[model samples]
Target: MATTVRRTSITLPAARLGPENPLPALRTPADPHQVDERERVRFPPGMARRIGYAPLRSLLPVRRLDGYDRHRTPTDLEAIVIENDRLRATVLPGLGGRVYSLVHKSTGRELLYRNPVVQPANFGLANAWFSGGIEWNIGATGHTTLSCAPVHAARVPAPDGGEMLRLWEWERLRDLPFQVDLWLPEAAEFLLVGVRIRNPHQRAAPVYWWSGIAVPESPDTRVIAPADEAWHFGHERSLRRVPVPEWQGADRTYPLRGERAADYFYEVPDAARKWITALDGEGHGLVQTSTDLLRGRKLFLWGNGPAGQRWQRWLTEPGTDGYIEIQAGLARTQLEHIRLEATSELCWLEAYGPLAADPAAVHGTDWTAARDAVSRGLEAALPRSDVERAYQAWLGCADTEPKEILATGSGWGALEVLHGRFDLPGTPFDEATLGEEQRPWVELLHNGRLPQGPLSTPPGPTLVAPHWRDLLETAPADALAEYHLGVAQWHAGDRAQAVRSWERSLKTAESCWVMRCLAVADVESGHPKRAAERYLRAFELAAEDPGQAHAVLAGLAREAVPALLAAARAGDAGALLGALPVSVRERGRFRLMGAQVLLAQGEVREARAVFDAGFEVDDLGEGEETLSDTWFAIAERLVAGAGPVTESIRRRARAEHPLPDAYNFGL
Candidate 1:
């Protein structure tokens, strides 16, 4: 099941060559660049120059000391060495196992890599080469070069070198300032890529581009994004509904695993379609066009081999590494599409260039201006009224079903326990029906959502994920009570009773495990701030022995930081400052938050002070003050003259509505 991989070559006038036309002669491997309605590959006369546009020109291996840059080092192509200081770090996990070199340049940490283990002296499995340079190759006898570039393209070693399975190294000599170009040989091809990198900063930094090719293992690959949100996917594997930590630079792949290969794309805001999976089958494939840049249009090329070879061993690799992908959209652009909020400092074009009629150079409007237009459209669409109406509509729905009830299980117990929580008119449980040991925790469940953080020590009775507590005969029975009770109360909207029932189950015995359930309840009830405070108290209680204060505080802080920042971004004062510690008033994670508030209130000088202080520090660590802290302080300074001081009132808000469901709830 092998087909020869070939690339098309083109000729251009030397006078036309300049900063643009980085690789003028480079063309599609299939010798065609046009796709008809049916998406068959087409090789139009002007397709080569059409692919060569402004944005593509922008990506002509531009070198900049501060920003993105490419380095080409002319080395003895005969022998290649990629090594780092660490012993075990020499090899990346997935590759047939290619040893890499360690450099202290970016992350200041030593890691392994295979610079570019391509195939054929001019072609790469991971990279594609296109240029008008010297020729070279390493055949059975040894290495040889003709009119190609003076390079020794390293080839991936084959366990058994069959004529169809030869490995070649394609080298782009850095010293020569040569260019190597690679494009989808097929009119539409899926490109899957895997990149494992080490961030050099002691403080976390953003990886400007999450650019990887999406390749399809099978033919039936599809791409999808949320209809509402402006962005495609935020940080973490989950979508940002209420906002959580690391929401700023999230470009993670969704969780999807199975024997079948399905390539699917999801929007950032909607948790449903975050993944672009490829199903394991033959002759089935998909393609789509993005309104973004770099990726002219996505191509899903699959079933390249014999039928029933859809789930080939190579296609089984997890993530985009196994599936084909291209860069057209990212977190920021995806977000800007759905919401009319403040603009994010992001530019996808900077990484993959821009989309244009020409594949060889950059084209279309400049990304910054294009982003501005999108913002205008978003602003027009996302009025305050629209958001409010959506919120209202979302809140009015109360279709409690068996499946949903089960899913909202807090990862605990059975149906009977869930039913008990409902004291409906027709169906009722008598006092005698109540279990003695479970009554206490059940009562707590009736109290409402538990505080955020671990609800109890030693991890409360493992009612959820029952396998963990399978040894205890009582666990199943107790779980049944909890599950039924939860469902009943939840259906009736009697949150108090339901919360109390769940809580009482934990209090059955004085074991420390009950805290987590309580914490879950708190966050679920739209009271994370309250949960944070209660967690603090619970921590104090548990601290007498094996206090998890540090761990709990750290977790809460990590979770709260991003949410608070988002609230700040959205200008929700109460949501921002309420139930929060004064220690965090204008400090740490909330530093920028506080500054935004001040700036909004017309506190110029004071705001400047905040920014000034913030600029001084580089990193924001746990409980440590940095520039972010300074920003909050500045906001505080600006607000010093306004508003009456009020102590944070810790009032219990009734669970009238369901807590905002997580985007990727289970994940």
Candidate 2:
């Protein structure tokens, strides 16, 4: 009769999100930090200012989670269900609070792309992400670092006197706390989600929020939005304005029309109702509309190119239909960041439900008519004023404290709560949730210094936020405190101070972890040789510990050998690779590096054989072209045979090689 919330479990063949990589990710993201200022597009000056604001220099303090492998086993995942008569929504609290499945009950149709398996891929900011359903992306560009992370979930009062599922987490990048509240009213077709992002700091913060909804895609489906044009961004790394629905001699609205993956940010007029839809040939599909504050909408598709098709298979289990993303955000494009003022929060209400439009109109050549028909349908189903009214109703209920705890997320939020003395009512990051990871930081907060530990033992995770950095700065100097202090200074862009702190830490104790930190600084400072030397030394020290785990050895090698190769010390890299445990050297990442070493040593054929033998880097970063690049390099060497190569010769080499799909993650 009314909406209900319940905790449950779903069994799926899921890959293990293994332990986080102990190596600090010192390099900045491959993606550019800012939108190219040269691009000519007309935007209100206020909007333009927000777009060019603060962007992340590096995802520091957040380490890579690349220890996972491709092997998966049937496992039970905790889920939260919110249901009424017409809709049933299943939320996975453990995995970024992703809405795993949304069913339109009457027709027995799954409205979202319910992923058949929990396969983790290297798509997020922190290297591990998954495909399927609806995901809330926060923090900076790329998929949120929380893609496979747990978010605190609890039961709260709903606007319509029903139960609401609240999901909240401390977004590390911008140091903000955000919450997502999901509920459905009695007999309502649409699911209501109220989202809020709070800026607790004294100064302004750059906020990025994109609610990515993955709907089932098909050859006949066409995405429609209330805009005549869109800002198109493609694999070519450029952005330009293009007509909506039809572009580049094809109806770009259809996900399969293009040959490569792309993002289409619809230029929704300020006064227009914010909505986007993807309906099939028969005119029934999902529509997502949000209140005006969530101003931007987008369509992202893995087009019908070979790489795109291959990527779809790589991200999921075999024999399943793929999906396209319809996303909503605060800025006009994903590249831009919106400025959230100090002590203020941004709130918006979004509705997702099935929409039925005229098949002829939806699939017609007239883009305006198709979009208008869908917008009118959305209005008839749930009017803009009603959505606004719902937001007002939600605000009153949003502060109502949780009735019960459904699930628990990371202790990072609670650590922030304790540090800042935040007064978050409805979404409480309780002190009880603080665990082993936050234990040291908790001590640093209540006590004066970071607890000292043996140099042989790896350091715990670092905190680089201004508040934590201040504490680390005031703490008594020691190897433990100085090492973490360097990380914080580096995050703040004080490279000189970071180097000084690490060098001083070395006097107190010799640590591979601190040496690795210094090596990262060396690399950033353009001293590749110095970096290589430090990396090699770090690995040597780490190797001296006979009782160390294989993973530690493998992880250190993964960082060191790359630096050695970068410095043109391939011989040293080869020796390091040889020193690895046989099992470690055989891993895809090390094997790939080994092939590079062979190529450098003039053993081109041997390098080529490694590619021919076939291997997969399960932890490869998204858009990393190393696999295909190395493949082509070997092919070119074999073709030239110690001769001077020309462009045509390169072309011939590639023609002969014809990189396999397994290695072609180029886009």
Candidate 3:
């Protein structure tokens, strides 16, 4: 039978992706995780261009989705299945177009690690993501924002005459339109994927694309890539190139051999074939290969460390095998971004299939022979010429209109297309897809004035893109317009003008949003006390708006109470905490914050009760240390008797008051 595409499903226990926080995330990570100045000079020649680009300043237009918690129930996910005689690929269309499972029909082998549960964690850029399957990482340095979000999915004409599943989205962080087309040819062993990223704008934009594949890991599993050296990054602040396969007397190829979690960005030769594989001791497993344009390949190991093991266990069910990542990207390393010129495109073809090589050479001490064996196996399984041919064939029909539409994603893409007059040939963001979120901006774009909800209503999302900023700047000086204009200005790095704009908005009418914006500015200006006062005012304003969503109020409280505690206004913090409904206050995060507020007020006994009563932050981030830090602070306060908190006192407190396992979320 010819290749066929059909609707499918997978039901698993998944956490509730709670409502998005209705607050603008106006901050970005300030730390620079780059190679040391001395080490920079030693990097490969002409690598600076890729190493530096415009890192994001704020996720303004995309609100924070931190409200999700760890609650699980059986969930049914709609999927798309594309199968030929040899292989079957099931894609979760709603879940970032993730390739949920790829099984070889002949051998009955599952090529990818299929998780038993769809547990949401804080790994994604939007703060809610689950491990397993294959994820397409775009946007900035970390996981793509669409990790848990849906994308436009449709059925398009495949190169082999059968239909292919197409997934497209307008990536907002970089303002680029991209498409991923998956097709399995009749009787073919490999699943072919053609990806295209189009920059329809008039200026150059930084582009980042990485296809991440999670493969099952075992003690005998070894990841093979055609590279003699690699760029190694660890928990420590350093990125240095080291010998591949064997580093520091140990074979780094095995995922479980290391002591700590790390990423090894392989330095594949320009002339070498770009491919990576994770094979068992028998040298049979999955292999991912792509065209030369997709140059970078990497191996991410969770390693054998306690925190790493804990993280592994946390992502899946109680009894499940651990997994490692074999990824392919555009640049030599993910820390870098390849620049795509205006109105240009970055397109490539990738193939996933089963590979079998000589186990003796693959697992042997000789790295060159080992990689060579896998490379040859890839050439035999699916040659570079065949991949190029497939790319060309796909390009011929890339713009073929979808014969049928299956699913729809965010309306942001449609809004951008309408506003910018963008013509994406292969990927269409139809006007029919526009929804409520785009309604306000659409009105503002058509009419010259920005729309404002009632004063009793909380401020909604902000559109801080450059185009929206220009539009807002020219529109009448409405208070709401000015507030959003300030956010846009701040996003563009014009701090002084932003502050002035906020001041102007405040003069027109004081708003919680404006106050919060000013508070962030105040903190940046080294006035934490004034910032605290502004946050308190914003929290009070939040209280009066009963129409505000519960998530929004909790988000405001989360932001405000921390600022109050930072300013040592423990009484105000307690009052703000008390103002919340008991249901919201009893959540793990708020309870932890309650303990911090109590400790700040020297009420150690009351704070201890918070930790004594069991609680868990379901959405705890991968490396966040807030829970342990709060517990240690309370422990220190328990022993601090009208004395300055010293290192010795801290050590003694930690030694005597061991952090309870329930509350210890340290990484």
Encode model 3's per-residue lDDT on 1-667: one tens digit a residue: 7899999788899888888877777777433345555666777765655675666666767777777766789999999999989999999978899999999998999999999888888787778889998899988777888988899999999998988999999888888889999999889999999999999899999899999999999999999898889999877757888998789888999989997888899999899888999999999999999889999999988888777877887788778999999999998887787789999998899999999999999999888899889988888889889998998999998888888998899899999999999878878899999988888789889997777654456566788878899889998886888888888898888999999999998888887888888988887788889999999888788787776678866887888788888898999999988998777888888888898898889898898888888787766776678888888888887888678889999999999999765554344
Worst 10-residue stretch by lDDT in candidate 1?
A: 402-411
lDDT for each candidate structure: 0.26, 0.88, 0.86
Clashes of 2: 0
Model 2 agreement with the true structure over 565-610: per-residue lDDT tens digits: 8899999999999989887788799899999999988999999888
lDDT per residue (tens digit) for residues 314-376 in model 1: 112113223334323333321111111121111111111111112111111232332233333
- Candidate 2, after superposition: displacement of residue 143 in Å? 0.7
Flag the better candidate by TM-score, 1 or 3: 3
For residue 539, model 1's alpha carbon misses the true position, in angstroms, by: 1.6
Model 2 RMSD to the real structure?
A: 1.5
Q: Tell me how far the alpha carbon of residue 261 in candidate 1 is from the true structure, in angstroms, after superposition.
A: 31
Local error of candidate 1 at 263, Å? 19
Which regions of candidate 1 deviate over 4 angstroms?
Answer: 1-325, 328-474, 477-501, 510-513, 523-533, 547-549, 556-633, 636-667
- Per-prediction RMSD in angstroms? 26.3, 1.5, 1.9
